[model samples]
Target chain A: MEKKQSKLSIVTNGLLHENPNLRLVLGTCPTLAITTSVFNSIGMGLAATFVLIFSNMAISACRKIIPDKVRIPAFITIIAGFVTVVMMLVQAFVQPLYQALGVYLPLIVVNCIILGRAEMFASKNGVLDSALDGLGMGIGFTLTLTAMGFIRELLGAGTLFGIQILPDAVEPMAILASPPGGFFVFGVLMALAIMLDEKQGRKVDADPEKIGCAGCPNSKNCHGEGGCE
Target chain B: MLVKSSPHIRDNSSTQKIMLDVILALCPAILASAIIFGLRALLVIAVTVVSCVVFEYLYCRLMKKPNPIADLSAVVTGILLAFNLPSTLPLWMAVIGAFVSIVIAKQLFGGLGHNFANPAIVGRIVLAVSFAGRMTAYAYPEVTNGVAALAGATPLVATRNADLPLLTLFLGTHGGVLGETCAAALLLGGIWLVVRRVISPVIPVTYLATVAVISLLAGQEPLVQLLSGGLMLGAIFMATDYVTSPYTLTGKLVYGLGLGIITCAIRFWATSAEGVSYAILLMNLLVPYINDLTRQKPLGGGKRK
Candidate 1:
């Protein structure tokens, strides 16, 4: 029962408490880029989730064996390998989604969420915990992207998953599908997430000092007395 | 009389007074728009103003902050935003613009004085980008025997290769956004603000001069460039916005020069025929830096190391 509770907390933490996109603000590039359409967001989210879960598990399992000096490179290698696997599978199965995602698919090798999880949680925790963390973080990211996608697609294009929801009389705001609109939606969502978190009395850990060296991937190499500047 | 404190001088020009002056100044343009574009223009203006005030009130209430609508800044923002839109733009879209201007741009940033750029400019750009087709469908002012008609592109768009009637452009009887149509009316309004000392003429004069000089150099008709589009409206009203514009004299001049250069650049080189709003918005972002650069040194102050 204790183990189950711990596992559930780990997953729930990523969903809202430490949402990789809204809270921690990891992997912002993809969050802003592919969220113009619902289909692209889901596809990208699932792809990243697949990479995240496998990468977390692999990193956590090899945590003891990997040297401190070379751990970042090792983590990247593992992440890149999984990202490639996901890319190939996506290309083979879903050609349109693969095309839609385009360079963002390959760029997932360097996504901060995967690497951040590897450094912040997976490296210090057990494989099962790391995997659950990945799942939670992935879902949180997916939810954020989906929400953003829903707004941008609905308002900007007047459509949902390519289905026209707004009547012909109501013109869609074309800007919402564009880059500025993406940024606007992303900012509003982040604000809303923080506001909700605060309202629920879940003290938003915005200060870097509170997150401390534990959150930093370079903490292992830092020789600073108190913490990194 | 009761004994007062030692330093007893105070200017009676409160925010409310200044905003009221701005509204009064905008009357000529509003009247001209009504005469030119007919009653729908007034409807758009009315909807935008009401919506802007409502949004400001609602946001303050929701956030539990003191209501700022009494200051009439939102009313000014509403008028300016309405002026930026075409008369043909849907009322719902105008409300969206108002919400964006009042709530997102102004209130979210700590209300009127704290907004980084002019709220109306931000709203205009957002609407322009969002509903490009609707926003760009300029209504040509043609009142044929008591009925108004929409026809042709704005003078800026139409005059790319051909010259328009200078008198018609000066009088604002051309295709354009509702408020930008009449150069004469905008100038009248601009002069009123300047004369009332509500806004300093430094930014407007410098901005207009720069555009005139640049247009002359670029081989474009300087008079047409100056009189056409939202150049006068933006320079007089939006660029001189106190909260977004620089403070010192030098800062204001620099800001105006930057606005002119960007405006002319966009007009000449870019695809967009009109660049007044975008130029103002872009220059607004650099106001802090401009203010920093042009900070006045005190007497007997030591030079920085």
Candidate 2:
């Protein structure tokens, strides 16, 4: 029962507490760029999620065999391989979404959420936990992107999934569909996430000491000094 | 008498007083716009002002912050925002502009003195980008025999093909946004602000001179370029806004020069006929950097070791 609860928490954490896009603020470029419409956001989210899960599982399974000195490059090679597979599958099945996502689909290999999770959680954890983490983080990112896209599409274009919801007399704000609108929506949503997190009485756990020198990935290299006076 | 801290002195000027002076200075242009654009101009201005005040009051009440409506800054922002818009703009759209100016641009950034850019400029730019067609649909001046004239393009749009008599431009008989039509009224208002010491003349003078010099070099008629579009209104009013503009004299000059260059670059090369609002917005963002570079050293202070 304890093990099952831990597994569920690992997934639920990403849904809110450690949301890859909103909480951790990873993969911001894709978050802001492809979130102009609901369709593109879902396509990009699922594609990244596929790559994320496989990459996390593979990296966790190979963590021991892969040398510490070259672990980063090894992880990247694994991520890039899975990214290519997802890209091909997306291209074959969803041609329009594949085109809409364009360069972003292939750029998922460089998404920080994938690499950061691979380094932080996957490499030292069990393969099952790593996969769970990927699933949760992926859902979080997808939900956030979809929320952003929903707002941008509705206000900027007065449509949802390409269907007009507002009356014809209502002039949609065109700027909401542009880069500035994307940024505005992104900022407001992030604020809402933070506000909700606070209202739920769950501390964000930003304690500096917890994330300081001891928690740093470079702790081993810097001899735990971290250059602080 | 209650003893306070030593060396205490205070000026009679408050935010309310200063904003009132600005409103008074804007009266000539406001009257000119009403006469030129018809009573709809007054309606537009009234709606924006009321909406701006309401938004500010509501935001303050919701946030539980001190209400700032009494300062009259929102009134100034409302007038300036309406001035940037066409008279034919829908009333609802004007209210949207007010919400942006007051709630988003001003209050969101901590209000009044803390706003990074002029609220009106942000509102104008957002409205322009969102409703390009309506924002640019200029109504011709209706000063002839009290009849609504046909819709026409602003003089800036026709600058290349036609030579508009400088007098008509001076007298404010033209198709343009509400306040930008009359150079004479704007100048009158600008001079009033300067004489009242409410605003320094450095920014407006430097901005206009730079535009004049650049226009001459570009082989365009300098006077027409200076008098056309929103240049006169922008240089005289918006660019000199205290909160967004730099403090030091040298910083002010640099800000003015940058505005002139960007405005001319857009007018000459870009697809847009008017660039005054955009130029001011861009320069406003750079004020902090300018202030840092031009900060004055204390008297008898030496360089840090």
Candidate 3:
């Protein structure tokens, strides 16, 4: 990614520099839906991370074998395989989280982050690099989801991980546990991420829409070839 | 080297001046709230205003943007947010509402004119959802000092055909939220804003008229519908928000009509006793489409539907 890239940087990139959620703005559907509680977010993050790592590894290893034109379908097939495994594992061991995540667990197969990384990073990089990238992105996604969940759960319920934090005088705002609060928290965290990026001497894009839609691989088919226009 | 943008012909009014005019218009409602809800009304307003200003100032400072508090928009947001809350709402809750209004609704959307919806209305809706029990608890208005001595159902909940004197409703000598109870004061403030050319009359006039028409058609008392709830306050101030309401006359009429229908539906059929805030909020989300639909065509001809 740079003049002096290292194995560690590949992993760390996903955690901070190129966070799938904060920087790439990928996998937003699951990110917003399952991030209402820290417990649920951590569970979702781990499950997605597992799927991303295996999918990236499998895709990178088969990159030479798979044709370029049919790569999206191939990559999705690989990711969906991993998602099924993880979904089953969660259902078997963590029944509560399985219930909490509900439909989102299966929907992770289509999360842009996994498919985006497989196509953009994995298809080009070595197996080691792809696995590291998956781990980093997973960690970053997990951290972001947890942060949102923590803030939302704290404000919306006046508790942190079910522990009382705020004083009795402070009334909890229950709306933060809902959809609009999810959007608000997401926007605020994005603004914070942009600011943090600037503080670290990195050039983050000022335009949110640009950052989101710029590197999207499916841009050519956006709105279905002239959709609503 | 006059590097200028569109609307080259400008008026003397500034954002600050326009905001000041709005604040002036809101004064009667604020006074009414104080008289009807007592010292706590002023307390909630003060807390919300101070917090809104502080949050905006801190966000700008931390983000290294030019301070935006000078526009006085935060103050207006604070007043309006307070207007939407019950007087008995804890000061901390009001502060949270202010934060949502200023930090989330206003600043996050790129501040001031760039906001997608009315910040105060967003704050109110957020607070209402988060603290539903506290937000809905209405206190009976005191005859002596206007502060409620105890909690009670407002006219909206009193009975199916609750009939208080029109004068009492007009004067706001009843149990309700801080600013919504007083119809006369709200009307006065609205008229003043209209006189000062601060807001277009289309939204308020059409919104109120639609509510009246719906009330009569629904076999309810139109005057009671007009006088009893937050209809006047929302029509005058919240729904007429320059940023959230439609710009064109046709769009405004549509916006008003939609608002009226939503308000009536919510008040009559929905579980909520008042629907003005939710009505304005829903309409705020639709303003952009309404503007697009009703945009003025070009001088000769424009694209057709």
Candidate 4:
């Protein structure tokens, strides 16, 4: 007899409780490196989703046939095949996006989120559950990446998907457009997410114990508990 | 109930203390600048410090917050800000920089360690954009002559426009900001800060190495690049800022290297000559993720993956 978790749980889990980007913090390189615009985020997210879905299905189908001893290698091979296909398709049709994303497009092959899902959930679950998990996770990642893209592009460049969202009089915060700005936005958003979760009477994922450099020399006598907040 | 109430040893370190230590370590550079630029340096420093402190005080009071200026953080910020600017910088510019550094960069982001980018760098960049000619225009101290020296190009300006002598740049005879004019003094201050345990050595060493390597690769004078402009000041002070810099040793090295590489690229290739400020500001934005990736609790002590 199979015990069932409702599908709503699967979707909501990705949205917050089990968010791949915020909670697990997987796919961070792409999240930080390529999210300079809404288009980039959408492109990265869709490409990753496609890879995730196919990889999840392939891994689940061959889970039993593949030996446990070499499961990691087997998983890598499957992921590589899907990623190669994604690369060619992007190069052919979405060349602009492929150019914008650069190396990060191919890096999706090793993205921790896809690999993490394959190792933890896809391998053990039935094909349907695995498919749902991939879809939920894919959507969650797409939304988060897009949100980050929206904030970075809107504030950094005064554009979202290349459309101006702010008045001309307002000076853009140029730092938000650069790599350091990306991390700053990422931290603030992550902190806000935790705060909102707590306010909504949900279990917040933020652990002050784990938020920063805890034992760092600077942390000991600086900023109350850490050097700086 | 367990009885244990006698005078227990409390850690003497505090944000205020660390900030004060950094200011003290920076005193040499500040004093050196006062000597070089004379009363002009003192006036600029005073304006910067007072404006930064006043702005922070007013903002906190307006925001209905506790007086954060008591921590002496704004004081440190002011000193660092003055270090980056030319000693002959107009009083209005320094005051404007104070407002921007305190209000926009520091207070807007919730103050102190919460700012994403270093406040001093932000203020410098704003000044650079608003007054490009003034920001880059440099002047030598008028010690021999009675009259104040007119504006002249720094070694970096010379390097960009017409490559200058490396030795002259190193010796600080060339035109530049007050403190940045003396590479030797900045190095001494950096060493003092490191020895005092005020800042780690990773950032300064790695940042310098990266810039040196990149400069060599680009067929430029590595020594000149190392000694010119704000590279020393940025690497030693701004890049090592606790709130904006990475924490772990590995992360700090990576952060420093990244800053150096970015700085070299901007200086040699890009149009901007003030590369240090931009590079450190960019690295500051990356601090959180750097700490996240590098901060590993002891094995068996770590939270679940």
lDDT of 4 at B185: 75
Tens-place lDDT digits, model 1, residues B99-139: 88998888877897899889999999999998889898766
Cα displacement (angstroms), candidate 4, residue B145, comes to 12
lDDT digits (tens) for residues A85-194 of candidate 3? 99999999999999999999999989999988887788878899899989999999999999999999888788877789999888777888898889889977877887
User: Tens-digit lDDT track for model 3 on B1-305?
Assistant: 88688888879998899999999988998998888888888998899999999999999998789998999999999999999899888787888889889988889788998888899999988888999989887666766654332336776665364577688888988888888989998999899999999999999999999999999999888988888878888999999889999999999999999999999999889988889888998999999999999999888896767
In candidate 1, position A62 carries an lDDT of 99
Candidate 1 retains true contacts at a fraction of 0.92
Q: Point out the higher-scoring one by lDDT: 1 or 3.
A: 1
Encode model 2's per-residue lDDT on B1-305: one tens digit a residue.
Answer: 99988768877889899899999989999999999989999999999999999999999999899999999999999999999999999999999999989988889778989998999999999999999999998888756555322435677777787777799888879888999989999999999999999999999999999999999999999999999899999998899999999999999999999999999999998998989999999999999999998988889999633
* Candidate 1 lDDT score at position B198: 92
Task: Give every collision pair in model 2.
Answer: none
Fnat of each candidate: 0.92, 0.92, 1.00, 0.00
Q: Rate the local accuracy (lDDT) of all candidates.
A: 0.89, 0.89, 0.86, 0.81
> Each prediction's Cα RMSD?
3.7, 3.9, 3.9, 10.5
DockQ (C-alpha) of model 4?
Answer: 0.05
The number of the candidate with the highest TM-score is 1
Top candidate when judged by DockQ against the true structure? 2
Clash pairs detected, candidate 4: A180-B285, A219-A227
